[model samples]
Structures are given as C-alpha cells and as structure tokens.
Target: MQIRDLPYTDPGDPDVRSGPRFLIWLGRNQIRGQLKSLSWGLLHQCSIAGLPLVIGFAVQAVVDRSGNRLALSGGLIAVLGVLIAVGDTMLHRTAITNWITAAARVQQLLARKTAELGSALTRQVAAGEVVAVSTGDVEKIGWFVEALSRFAAAAVALVIICVGLVVYLPSLGVLVALAMPVLALGVLPFLPRATRRADFQREKAGKATELASDTVAGLRVLRGIGGEELFLGRYRRASQEVRKAAVRSAQMWSLISAIQVLLPGVLLISLVTYGAALARDGKIDVGQLVTVYSAATLLLFPLRHVEEIAMAYSFSRPSAQRAVRVLSLSRVARPSTVDAAPTGDLYDPATGLMAPEGLFTAVVCGDPDEAGRLADRLGGHAQPAVSQEGAVEEGATDHEVPSVLLGGVPLDELELDAARTAVLVQDKDPVLLSGTLRELLDVPSSGRVTAEDALSAAQCDDVLNALAQASVDSGGDPMDTRITERGRSLSGGQRQRLALARSLVTDPEALVLDEPTSAVDSHTEARVAAGIKALRKNRTTVAFASSPLLLDLADRVALVHRGTVVAVGTHRELLRGEPRYRAVVTRETDDEIPAPAPPGKDEAIHAIDTIEEIEERA
Candidate 1:
C-alpha cells in the first residue's frame, strides 16, 4: 500500500495509448485533477515564453532611451524572473502529484478487475501475460495519462511562440515553425521498428518471469528427479532471450535519440543564421532579433524531448494494451436457477450423486482421480460459467468433472460468498496462515467461533498442549503460537488436522473434504473421522477418502468411476458390488468386505416411521 515501495506507475512513455487519447481517458475520469494539472502546465509554459519576451523588451528599451527607461524595464524583468521561478516550482510539484495519484488509481482499477474475474482472469489470458500486465503495463498506462497534460500545454505554447515571431519578424517566425513539424513528424519513419522491438522485449520478459515462477513451484520435484540443472539451463536460455530482446529495443531507442538530437541541431543552425541576416539587413529591430533567437534556443529543449517521448510512447504502448486486455476480461459464474431459489441439500443429477438433508455421505470413487474431481465439484470449486479453466492437476489422469451441483442447483451457479457458505472444500494443500491458533481457526472474519470451541471439536486438546509446552523452541502458547509460512514447522498430520479443524469451524451447510486425515496414522485418522462425524450432526458432509476407517464411518458411500458416479451405497456395499471401488479403498489389503446393506432398507424403514408418525399425530 505504500506508494514509495510500489513500482514506478509512470512508465515514462512505454505506455500504449496516444498522448492525446490518454489525456482523454484521464479527463473522462479525473477531470478535476486533469484540469488542475493542465492549468499548472499552461502557467509553466507561459513563464518560459514570457521570460524571453521580457528580456528582449528590456534589452530594446535600454538601447532606445540610453538610460531613462532602464529602471522600469529592469524592474519588469526582475518581476518576470521571480514569476518564472515561483511558477516553475509550483507546477513541478503539481505535475508530480498528478502523475503519482493517477498511476495509483489505475492500479486500483486493475486490482478490482482482477478480483472480479478471479481465477478466470488467467484463463482468459496467458498467466504470464497477466502477471506482466498488472505489474508493468498498468504503470505505463498511468504514466502516459499523466504526461499527456504537460505535453499538450507545451505544444500549445510552442505554437503561440511561433505565431508571435511571424507577426513581429515574419522570416524568423516561419523558420522556427517549420522545425516543429519536422521534429514531430519526422520520427514516424523509426516508430514502427521501435514499437516492434518494444513488443519483443515485453514478450521475452514475460517468458523469463513465467519460467522463473514455474521453476520455483516445481523445485521439490526437480530436485527429486535431479533435473535442477535442466531447469536452470531452461531459465538461463530464457534470460538470454530477454537480454537479446532488450538490446534490440535499446538499439532502436538509441537511433531515435540520435535523430531527435541531430535533426534539432541542424534546425537550430539554419534559424540562427537566417535571423542574423535579417538583423544585419536592418529589416528587423534588435529587440525582435533577440526574441527570435531566444524562441529558437528554447524550442530545441522541448522539441528534442518529442523524440524521447515518441520512443517512450512506443515502449509503453504494448504495456497499456496488455493492461487494457486484462481489465477487459469478463467474469465467470453465469446466472442459474440457484439464483432464483436455492435448492437446500446438495444434488448432482448428472452424476447421480445426492446428499439429502442431514446425511453423512462417503464417496467411493472407483478411480482416485474421479473421487478428487467429484470432491471439487461437491465443494463448488468447479462449475459451468461463461469462461472455463484448465484442470488443477491433482496427479495422474484425475481430471475435474464438468458439473457439480447442490440441491438441483449447480454449485457454480451461486455467487462466490454464497457458494463458500453452502459448501467448503479443504484443498489437499494444508494452508497454514501466519497468525495465533485462535486466528487460524478464525479463517479471518466476524462471527468466527472461539479457538477453544473449534479446537475441542477437532480433538486438538493435545495440539494446544504441545503448542503451550515450552522447549528449546519457544515463542508463545501453542494456541497463541504463530504458524510459519505454509506451516513448514508443523508436522504434515498437524497441518492437515488444523486445516480440517478450520473447515469445521466454518460449519458450512455441506462440507466436502479431500483426504482430511491422509497424513495421519490409523489411530489419528480414526479419531478425526469420529470427531468429524460427531461435529457434522445434522449438516451434510461429503468426504473423498479411501481410508477404510473413514469409509466405515460413512452412512452411505458412492463410487465414482471416471468422471461419473458408478454406484451408490455404504463402503462395504461398494466393495462387494464394484471391484474397482474395493481395489481403490483397500489398495494395501486386497481382501474385500461384503456389502453392508441395501439403501432400500433405510428408505423402507423411513417410510414406515413417517406413516407411524402421521398416525400418532392423528
């Protein structure tokens, strides 16, 4: 949030929009700031032109009256100097603040847009491109928008100075006017090449960043396979590519700089030579000659900058285009029947998986991949939307299913907050936040359950004791002890149990947990299952687990084969009915358990109880 720490927002001209167009966008949004900046720029430009004129007038006056008018002209010249100094300082401050705030606002807008699109943002664009756009491109865009105001005012002042000279000394004025167009338009020849080089540089930079990110994420696997050097080589190649692209961009920019500097030098010589001739011919007065020379001299300082600005524009335009592209991405999550009236218990009619109200459902996917995919769907992580995302690789061919629903409604149909409330998925990764035990259980919000309550329910009394115990490692009570990044300090089971406990605290309507006790031993896994069962009570709970202990605890188990549910029954039932289900559930022990019972027994008994209850009421 600190402005000083942020990357430079004013990308100095590598911005994509034309200077005028950028001003138009800024004027549309921050009209007040734009106008204020414009006002300051105008004043600053006026000071430059005015100072020269005042000097020209004072010199003429001294020559004309010998010394009689000297005092008045000298005082007027002093006033002009003071105004120029004061105006220049104030305008400089105003221009800087204007750019800083404008860049900040554009960054805010990009962040807001990213949040709206969420995961879909990357799916709509290359992930590397999104990273580059948010960082580099957004800043470039704001830079151009800020620079446009001053550029516009400077341009107008240049024109005004040219016209004034034409009237006072026509010959000198016309030559100076001719130089401005050549400076502005002559650079057109080199801009295309410059833009092409800029695009290449940006593209290479994105690749380098992507390679770096991917390598870091896969360091563990790479180290295991002894492929660290292979990846390092890849990154090295990417870095080299980036270096080459940068050199090309710099070369083109250098060429543009040469033209900006060299051409203006040529123009200055011609103007000075022509002006002196007019002065020697006695056609133009000495005062006019001084004014003409001053304008031409001052003109080059601004005019040469035009070439630098042209190259800056070329450098920044691609970044702006990328940023604009990212901002333009549409959000996913289409409107559905769930929006009309939320269907209570979770339902997936397509896959024939249903957890009716107040049921302890265990899914037994014949394929481990299918089980995990179904878990994500049940958890509302995957759903049909205007946009689609690539599968989050969970290892080995276990891809995400197309549709997962709650009640009759597709989980994706619900808004994000609503979906989180309805179904909570504890991803395989045990996310350990940096906070006290109470805060970790809290999941960051109001209405959070107390740490003591969630811990007791999770059977974390021992965990708190361990945390509270003082040893060579000492920080605070286990309950108060902060978890390290990714909870690297904690054991795998500790991390998993803590994550499961956090989800339990949310107490969502339907909970979908993926191997909540995978890291724990048999005894701990059994305890977690019992604790989870006791805590769920009336709420629907769906778990994707192959552990026999957790499987035995399920009221009913469904077998998911491939991307669809193959069978629905208790854990024992699936073992007997489906070989694949039995094989997955008892991979360690090939022996299978018999079916527990037919689902009809519970249904038939429920019907009888309903009839008897009605009779009792009558």
Candidate 2:
C-alpha cells in the first residue's frame, strides 16, 4: 500500500521470533516501497558521482584552449546538475514515505494487539516500555528501514567511482581504491561498544518514562499523602541516570565520527600531495591531477552515508528487539467450542460465588484487593501467571478451562465476542477516553436506555453543568464538550458517574460493577444506588461494594470473607444476624472498645442525624 493509504485496515500479523527477524519481516512487507526508494537513491548518488568526472573534462578543455571542447564540457556539466537536483528531491520524498509507512504499520499492529489483550497487556508489560515502543522505538525502527536502501545506493555509487578513477588515472586510482575500503570499514570495531551504550541509554530512558507516567497518573493521590516530593526525587535520579547514559553513548558515536573524518582527510591530503608532485615532474598533466583531487573530495559524501548506516543500525536493533518483545506476548488462549452465548446464573468455582439470574447481588469482601480479583474472575478474567518482572512465566497457563461458568458452560469455551456480550465487568478504576460526552457514552448497546436517560440515572446533571460551563466560551453544547485524557479534567466522582452511564448504556445481559460509587459522597451514593437498582430491574447485576448505602438496596447481599462467601442474605437480615458481615460492611475493628461519651456527645450526634433527616425529607 502507498503512504496515502496509511493506517492499514489490517497490519498483517508480524513475525516476532527475534528482533532481526522482525526487521526482516518489515522489510519484506514493504519491498515495493523500498525498491522505489532505492531507485531514486541510485539516481541521486550516481548523478553526484558523475559531477567530478564532468569537472575533470571541463578542466581538460580549459587546458587545451579549444572553444568547441569547452562548450561541450559546460553543457555536460549543466545536464549533470539538472539530474542532481531532480534525483535528490525525488529521493527525499520516497525515503520519507518509506519511513512513515513502516512506522505506521508497526503502530497499527501494536494497537490491534492492545485491543486483543485488553488490560492483560499492561499486566505483562511495563506501561513505560509500551509507550517507548510505540513512540520512540517505532521512530528508530523506521529510521533503520528507510536508511537501508539509501546505504545500498551509496555503496554502489562508491564502487562505480572507484572503478572510474582506476581506469582514468591508475597511479592515484590504485591508492584511492585501497584507502576507500579502510575509510568505510575503519569504525566497525567500535560498533559493538556503541550499540551497548545506546541500549543502556534506551533502558534508562524507558525506566524514567515509566516513572513519570506513574507519577502523573497518581499526582492527586501523591499530593494528598504529601509524597509528591519523594516521587519527584526518585524521578530526578532516574532522569540523571538517563542523561549520563546518553552522554556515554554520544561520546562513542562522536569518536566514530572523528575517525571517519580523520581517515578521509588523511586520504585526501596524501592524494593531493602525491598528484601535485606527479604534475611537477610532468608524469601526469594538470587536468588529470585536478580530476584526482576532485574525485577524492567527492568520495567523502558517500562515506558519510556509511557512518549513518552504522549509527542507524546500532540504535534501531534494540528498538526492534523491544518491539518484538511486546508483540510476542500472548494472552491466555482459551479454546472456543460453544457457538452461542450462554445465559443463566454466573458462577465462579474458585470462590464458590454465584450471582442468581434476574437479581441484584451485592458482594462485600473483607479485603478490598480480594474484591477486585473476584470481580475479574466473575467476568471470566482470571489473572494470568505473570512474573515480578512483568513477563509470563514458563509453563504458566490460565486454567485449562475457565473457573467462571455460565449456564454450566465455561465462559472460555465460548467465542470471545460471545463471552463479552454475555458478561460486562466495569473494574474499580474504569478509564474514560478523551472525546465528547455524547461520544464517550456511545458504545454497542441494546438500545433500551438513551444517553440522556442513563446520564439522569447516574445523577450526572451536575457533571453536565460543569462540562457546559467549561465549554461556554467555545459556544458548544454540553454533550459536545471534550473531555481530557482519561477524564482527568473532571472530578473523581464526575469520572466515575460518567463511566457508570457508559456501562449502563450497553445494557448487557450480566453487569459486574466494582466500587462504582466509591468516589461519591454518602448523599450522592444513595441516589446512585437507587438509580442502579431501578435501571437494572429484572436483569442480572453483581456489585462488589462495601457501602451500606448501596447494600441496603440489593435484592441479596453476599458476604465474602477470606476469598469465600460466608453468608448470603438480605442486607438487613445479615446486618442483624451476622456480626462478621456487619463488621466488614461497617468497616469496624475489634481494637476499639466502647467508652463513655463526653457530656452532650450523644446530643451532638442526634443533632447531626436530625440535620441529615431534614435534608433527606426536603
């Protein structure tokens, strides 16, 4: 496909066996573009190489003092100049096309992989590493890909120049040919060291990037805990490490550049001195001496391309390797045997938790972490076995069959799309993508609920007002106002309510919500809980929450202690009969003993309750 047809409808599956292999695969896929670039590069470099020859002919004509010969030489020089301008311009255009297309293809592939893996990708790879791969690493790989053809064209032109010089002036030509190879190959020994230093720099930079990403994501929480300075210091150290590594890498590349310059200068000096001596002794004419000098000087241009090729490879190899590492990752592959989506109660065998169909079931976990894990399992998202270093361990497998089942059939046995349609899980930390408020809520849905209805049910009228006020200067509708990335521009409660509205719009068969109202105050939580119950009426719903405001509205509440359900009953029934369940839901600890209150403490508590009751009645 051409560059204009970018963002391929499908960036074909990449060969991810190794870094070099991945690069080779990329090259093979874009062979047509590479060849086009190579052709243009050849025209450009060949035209440049022909310049010294034309200059020599002009010099010879001047020496002969023939007007006819001088005119012919000048005409030839003009022709070569035109060819040079045309070739160079086209070469640049084609080369840039190749670079952009290659990078775009890789980005498309990464995006596809990310969609397929979902949240599991971050669990298996560092967020920073993925960012590095898609951004900086992608550019490096593209640089190497585009450089390959140009390097080939330069090498070919160098060969042609050496051959032409040998035939035209053998004495100097022999020296030129011999020294050119040394100039080209002189920096080979230092490449390994340079590559290592570059790799080190890239690693440090990636770590720093990951740290920065994490810091920004949690900046609000850090400030709340007064730990922002602590993290800033850590990031400062990481940034310094990156700077030091970069300096080391730069020092090596600088040394190589010096060698390239020094060797070529020496060759030019020797050729000029020797050729001048020959001309003085009348061994060769002045025009022949001029040709040798010009040829030696022009050769340096192509030799610089040789140095560029080395530098590109040194930087891109590691980048390609990192890209391959991310591409090679696979999620827990489950066999798909069932064709149709199953319907019935959702069951998690591992936790012995069941959510009966057509009911609102509230789950209260003694530990919040366990609640998140249980929520994942209930939705067929069993955590894969990943190492501390964020890699899948050898022999790791996400059960042969899913631990979660629907209608007595394992969820993993059904097609992925079917399983997702059957159950939708909104995690504790749901992300809101940047877009208009209307677009944010526009997802695949049963169409039972409209966006307006969902927004009202989620008590998002205040959010709407905020968005409208924020967009008043732009003269845009509230629904059209844009959200910042991850909805960071909104308050935490606003983001949560918006996410809930999106999920409600989907109207899935089974909905699992984890801490959906955690960010809201008690008053808002009460309305949200009632709205969810009213909206999800006669549908299967499971909520992993501890708030009594939410639990009081549940049709049935399950108390999960130590990863297993210990009690299942109505909210009031459990609160009165099960002390363990009450302790969990109320967040009460045994460490505190009841003590006599100060005079009027009870009166103060009664006064606050009276105010709340008055507000509720109003």
Candidate 3:
C-alpha cells in the first residue's frame, strides 16, 4: 500500500487470538508487499555478497598480468555497484511501505474497537494503556513485521554465500559455515532472559503511563482537594519504577548485543587465521585468502539481523498483546438478529422505572451509580451478562442481567443502530468534543430542532458569547467559535450547558438526561428546566435529577430508593407527602431543615417566580 492508500480502504479482519498470531496475520494480509520487500532485500544482499568475489577476481587478474580479465572485473564491479545502489534504495522504500501499512492497519483496528466499546472502553482497559498501544505499540508492531522480510532475505543471502564458499574452497568454507551458525545461535540462550526483562519493563511502563494519565485528567480535582503533591509523588515513584525496569531490560539487551558483536568478530578472526595458514601451505592463493576474509567479514552484516529480529520480537510481543486485549472487548450492544427499534414506554425492570411516551419524567436516585446504570439501560446500552464465576472475578455486584424493554420488545434484542437513533442518553458528565460550536451541536441532525433553538433551550447564550470571544474569527457568528478538547478551556457550567445543547439538537424520540443542569446556577437551572419542558412538550424526556427546581418542572417525578422506584407523583404532591422524597429533592438531613434566607428590603415577595413567568409566556 502506498502513502496515498493510507487509512486502508479495507484493513481486513484481524486475528486477535494471540500477539504472535496477530503479527502473522499482518504478514499474510500484505503478502504482495512482503514479497516486494523480500525480493528487493535479497537483490541488495546478493550484490553485497558478490562484491568480495568480484574484487578477488580482479586482484588475481592483476597478479597474473591479464589486462583483459582486469577490464572485465572492473565492468562487473561497476554493474554490482549500480545493482547495490538500486536494490538498497528500492528495499528501503518497500520496507517503509510495509511498516506504514502495518501500523495503519493496527491503528484502524484500534480506532474501530474504541468506537465499538465507547464509554465502557476505559473500564475494560486503562485510558493510558489505550493511548500507549495506539501510539508506541503500533510502531513497535509495525517495525517487527517490516523487519521479517529483510531478516529472511539476509538469511537466504547468508546461505547462498556459505554454499558458494563451500564449493570454491572446502576447508575454509566448512570452518566459516560451522562458525556462522554458532554466532547466530550464540544469543539464543540469553533471549529468554532478555524477553522476560523486557516484558516486566513494559508492564511497569504501562502502569506508570496509566498513573500519569489519571493524574492529568483529574488535576483540577486534585488541586481542589489539595492532593496534587500526593498524586505527583505517586507518579514520581511509578516513573522511577518504570525507569529501573527499563534499565534492567537494557542491561540484558546490552549483554546480548555484546555477544552478537563479539561472536562475529571471533568468527572473522578465526577465518582470517585459518585462511592465512592455507595460503602459507599453498592450498589457497593470496586472492583466495582475501576473498575468504572479505566474505567472513560481510557475513557479520546478516548475523546482526538475527539479533535485531529477536529484539524486535521481544519488544513488540507485549505491545501486540495489549492491542489484542483491547480489541477483544465484547460490545454491550451487538447488531441484533432483529432489526427494528420498538416504540412505547422505556422500561428497566432492574430499576422498576418506566418512562412513558410524550411526557416529561424525572427520576431521583440517592445513589448516582444506580441512576447512571438505569440511564444506560434505558438507552439500550445494557451491561454484559456476568455468570457466577465471572461475577466473582469482577468483584461483588448484582450479577443479574438488566432487562430493559422498549414498547414490548427487549432493548438488547433490537438492532444497535435502530436503538441508538431512537433513544439518546446524555451522561451526567457529557463530553464536548473539540470543534466549532456549530459542529459540536450538529450531532446526527435530527432536523426537528435547530442549533439556535437547542442553544436557547439549554441556556447556552453566555457560553456562546464566551466562545465567540475566544474565537480566532472575530467577525463570524458566535456559533462558529471553536471549543477546545473536552471543552477544558471553558468553565464547568459552560461545558455542561454546551453538552446539553448538543444533546438537545439530536432531538431523539426518547431523550434521557442525567443531571443536565447540575453545574448551572439556580436561576439558570430553573430556566433550563422550563425551556426543556416547553420544547419537549408532546415528546418523551426522562431526566435523572435531585434539584427541586428541575423536579418541580417535570410532569411527573419518581423517587428511586435502593435501585427501585418507590414513589411516583407530581413534584409538589410528592414533596408534601413523602419525607424521603422531600429530603432528597431538598438535599436536607433529618437533623436540619435550614430556614430560607431573608429577602432584601427592595426585593418583592411575588407569589410566582421567573420560572413560572417563563412557563406562562411559553
């Protein structure tokens, strides 16, 4: 594949069984590319090997005073030089192509897996490990795969040189052949130890990487809790552990490298000594002695490749394993045998909460985890089934498979794409991907709700103005302003509002929002609730929240206690009748019911508020 064909048209199905198997699969997929690399590599090495023989013949011609033979040898030398130059150039080109294609293929697989696994990917694999696998691991894997063809070509060239030497001069050839194998095999005994050290080092490095990534992601929280130094010290120790492991791995590899060099030098020295004695005994000519010495020295080139291939394998094996582990994650929502998304009440039997059609329902859960899980299920992202043994391995949690149904059909049984299109679940901590404000809110483009409408409903005018001021394009609409990754440059409330606006633009048939207004001020939250309720009139909208203002605006509110909906009523009715419901919605403990702050003398005590005024206008 050429550079232009990168991001492969078809990366082909990968073999995720084992690291070695995956590497083999990569080779098999690019057989033509591998052949091209192999052919060029062989031509290059063959020309190099032939050079010594040509030079030896030229020397003999000079010694015998044969000018015609000398001219012929010179012509041959020129041809060999051209051949070497072209062969080496083409070999490098093909090798690079193979490397790029291999890396691209692996990266594509990783991207696909990340999309398939979605938010649950971090639960299955550390975010840092995923980053490491996609970046560093991909290159290592590609390097080893690309090295295979050249290593094989070198081995073939070595064999050809040995066979030719044996035919031309048996005594020296036998010595060199036996010694070459010994040189290649010399490092084998040390490889297992080196590989073990390398694996240990890689494992420690992954841990360090994970720690660093977690620390960076939570830096704001760490600073807030005055734990920056604690995490920094933790990361420092982790980084040191990684360094020590790497040093140990390097020591083992250094020993192997030394052996690779030492054994080849010893072989060359022994061959030179043996060939010199033969020349002294008149069994070999001066030219033949020179040829033997040159060939033995040239043999060192291919010998080094053996060590390289081994080293490549040692480093890439663990990387491949990590990639395979991530690729092997089973998606919670598979393309089902059934192809339709059911219509009607979204029911989660596990939570005993049912959100019916064309209504604004609010679910209040004391435990946020239960609320999040319920929200996930309502949107057809069911947790995977865990058997008794699996549950034990995963830790103590309810192993029962959550049953969620849309209309009457089980959500998991419906096709994944259809389910997603029908239901949208905005998480409590929704992410705003880096892009222009317009692009961020252009998700799926349901065409029922426009960007302006959604932004207004989500109370994002301040956010839009702030982003506009941050934009490089001063004259453009505020919606054209760019948001940084995860909207990090924006305040927490701004990010939350922007994410809510994006979700609003999607306008799914069933919208499940979890704490969509938690970060905003009370007035903003009240406006958001009123606006959403008005815009989503005659549509299904289930919001999980505890704020009284948000719950007060819902058509119906359900109090979820210990993972089950225990009370369902109008917000006011539930507030007055149910003490647990009142406690949760008001965020009050039994020991304290704090008195409302006294209004200033100038403030008017109106019977109704701004939220009511907005509702009256709507």
Candidate 3 regions with alpha-carbon error over 4 angstroms: 333-335, 385-400, 590-618
**Candidate 1 vs 2: which has more lDDT:** 2
State residue 373's C-alpha deviation in candidate 1, in Å: 4.1
Candidate 1 similarity to native, TM-score: 0.80
Lowest summed lDDT window (length 10), candidate 2: 609-618
Candidate achieving the largest TM-score: 3
TM-score of each: 0.80, 0.89, 0.91
The segments of candidate 1 whose C-alpha lies over 4 angstroms from its true place after superposition are: 1-27, 65-98, 113-128, 223-225, 333-343, 366-373, 384-413, 430-448, 455-475, 478-485, 488-494, 588-618
User: What is the alpha-carbon RMSD of candidate 1 to the true structure?
Assistant: 8.2
Give the TM-score ranking, best first.
3, 2, 1
lDDT of 3 by residue, 489-602 (tens): 988999988888888888888899999998988889989999899888888899999887898889899999998789999887676557787677666687654344366622
lDDT tens readout by residue for model 1, 1-618: 234545544323222233445444654665666667677767767777776676777788877975646677678768767776776676666666666766676676667666555444554566677777667766666666666666766777778878887786777788878777887777789889888988898889988887887787567679889999999999999999999999988898888788877877888788778777877998877887788788777776556546655665775677766665554443433453354325467777558788876888887665666666566667654432232222222222343344566666666666766766777777666568876676787664224445555566666766666667632344656766767666656667777878888888887778888888878877777878988888787778888887778887888887777656778887656655566775676562344443444775765534533322422322
Model 2 reaches what TM-score against the true structure? Answer: 0.89
Please give the lDDT score for candidate 1: 0.68
